[model samples]
Target: MELDFSNIKVVGFDADDTLWVNETYFREAEEKFAALLENYETKNKVDQELFKMEMNNLELYGYGIKGFMLSMIESAMELSNNNVPPETITEILNLGKEMITRPVELLQGVEEVLQKLARKYRLIVLTKGDLLDQERKLERSGLTRYFHHVEVLSDKKEENYKNLLDHLEIKTNEFLMIGNSLKSDVLPIMNIGAKAVHVPFHTTWAHEHIAPEEHDNSHLTLNTLSEILKYLE
Candidate 1:
């Protein structure tokens, strides 16, 4: 879809895969986790079971590496029939720490695009996850100077975006969200009368997925963040 952005005053960006390498790390961690518990369960079963644990624990821990780590721990315990060794548990914790501390790798052209967009419109990092971890990654990323605001959402539903727009005093039509998930970044914003550009990441969490037929026709899709410049610039 071709979008006219003359009225887009605020541009929102999702942090994880949209800005940097996130889901890929999680994928790697899951592999390591599955391997750690392989003696107790098959790798495929462990992966399936971990996804279930994550979904069940979403309310309790929200989203982030910490929650994922906890889910892995719980899955390990259950897969092992509660006989998972203490050392293995410790290893799991360390795995999470490694991911949390991993170097931030921004996607191609992300910083350059942000730099350009920041000059013309209000750019904010609109993402959901552990507050401290998000902050840490932003600080480490060195992309902080381009963003006018950095919001960490608990969830990216319509209400959350509405509340944020209200808090920021931004008119619905004047806000534009650019991110990697159609489910979180595109659908809800479009529903709330705002514009969104879905910059799809190769890896998306299953919870954030919807059937292809369910996609609304009103939004625009971009293969890469840099492509946003064509419409916005």
Candidate 2:
């Protein structure tokens, strides 16, 4: 379907995968975590239980690596019947810290795309995460200069976008969102009468997956991150 973008004054980009490497690290950490707990449970079971732990803790912790580490620890203790070795817990903590300090690596063409769009429209980083961690990634990314506004939302739901549009004083039709997750990025923005583009990252957190029937026909998916330029330019 051909969608119009003539009135999109504010273009919102999801930071983690859309602009830089993120979920991939989480996946890596998860693999290491499962290996750490391999003695207590099968790797497959460890993976499954850890996901459940993370989902159950979402309300308490929101999104980001620290919460994930804590969940891993909790899962570890439970799997080992509270006999998990102390060194194992220490390893998990180190993993989380290493992730927090890892250098920000932007996706290919991120800078070029942001630079191109910023010249024509107001650009913003509208991502979900722990505020401090997200801000640190942005600071390291060096793409902060491209965005006119930056918002770190607790969650990307329909209401959140509605409130964001109100706070930015932007009409729904005048805003566009681009990100990697259909659940958190595309659908919510679409529900609010805004435009969005789906840019798939190689690895996706299972929670972000959604039924195809729930997606809006108006939303677009680009084959690659830089394809948005073809539509907007």
Candidate 3:
């Protein structure tokens, strides 16, 4: 179905997987870390333990680097039988930092699409992550110039969506959110009567991918970001 975005004045986007590469880098680091831990424990055991720790930490730390670092620390300590050397722990921390500091590689056509959309809509970047890390990514991505506002959110719940809409002084129906995650990017905005377009990424993190039951009533799902141009045109 084509979107009637003629009423849309503010176009909010989810930054991480939507605009650039995010979870794939983290997944690579995780696989490497699992390999390193194989020396201390079976890969299956280590993975199971790490999953538990990550789920627990997500409740406290939410998502992003902090939760990932905590998961790494717990995994290392568990696999080493609580005898993990300071050097090994430092190595893990360094790896986590490197993952965050890695250069941003924008998805194909992201720059061109943003450049085109910026001319027609008020663009805003709404992402959840460590502030400094997100800022570094935006700086490196070279697409930051097109956004009118950049929001670093702790959570992408209904309240956050409402707050952003209120701050922009726009009604929910007047905004459109384009993002990769159905859970974070599409559902919340749709709940508030805003339109949403889902642009599925090739590889989504376990946490970011949501099941069909979570689909928004007022949203459209697409296989690629470029599909949105069809609606806009």
Candidate 4:
């Protein structure tokens, strides 16, 4: 079946893994975090516990390094039976601080794709995370010039997309979303009758993983962001 983007007048992009190196940092942080707790638990156990903590705390902390930092600290205390040293907590905080300050490394062909798409479509950034962090990353990415509007959502649920579209005065039929996470970016957009293109990042956070049954065939998936030009441009 052929999908059409001829009606798409607005294109939304996800910030993290779609446009730059994000999950890679979180992965690296997890490794470092696991290593820090190796004395009390195995690396694998530490990894599992940290992910559980993040999920449990998702509602309270939302997302981003600050929340992740808290999860790591709490996980360390639980995994170590509250016997974890103060220095270990400091190190965990440092890990997140390091991530927050790390330079934004744009994915391959991100700029090229955005540049080309911006000319024909009203480009916007629709990423969800800590507001300040996402804004900082966008500033650091230097790709903000290409987007007409930028929105940092708390989550990428269907309602979030619908409300944002309405606020922007963009019709559902005229909106297209491009992102790496099928769970966050593709599923919701498609559910709302908008088009979506999936460009998978090499590393995806576990939370972003969706069940096979939840997968919709209506959206397009590209191996690389650059390939989108073949269809959109």
lDDT for each of the candidates? 0.93, 0.91, 0.84, 0.93
- Model 4 earns a TM-score of 0.98
Q: Is candidate 2 or candidate 4 better by lDDT?
A: 4
- Residue 75 lDDT (model 2): 94
Residues 1-233, candidate 2: write the lDDT tens digits: 58899998889999999999999999899899988988889999999999999999999999998899899999999999999989999999999999999999999999999989999999988999899999999999999899989999999999998998898898899898999999999988887889999999988999998887876456788878889998887
- Find the number of clashing residue pairs for candidate 3: 0
Query: Could you give candidate 1's per-residue lDDT for residues 148-232 as a string of tens digits?
Result: 8999999999999999999989999899999899999999999999999988889888888899898756788888999999998
Off by over 4 Å in 4: none
Worst 10 residues of 2 by lDDT: 210-219
Candidate 4 weakest ten by summed lDDT: 211-220
Ranking by TM-score: 1, 4, 2, 3
Q: Model 4 misses residue 70 by how many Å?
A: 0.2
Tens digit per residue, CA lDDT, model 4, 1-233: 36888998999999999999999999999999999999999999999999999999999999898999999999999999999999999999999999999999999999999888888999999999999999999999999899999999999999999999999999999999999999999999999999899999989999999988988577788899999888888
- Candidate 3 regions with alpha-carbon error over 4 angstroms: 216-218
- Give per-residue CA lDDT, model 3, range 1-233, as digits (tens): 65688888888888888999998887787777787777798877877788788888886877787678889898899789898888778878887888877889888778877888889988899999878888888999998899999999888999988987898787898899999888888888888899889888888877776776766345788777777777774
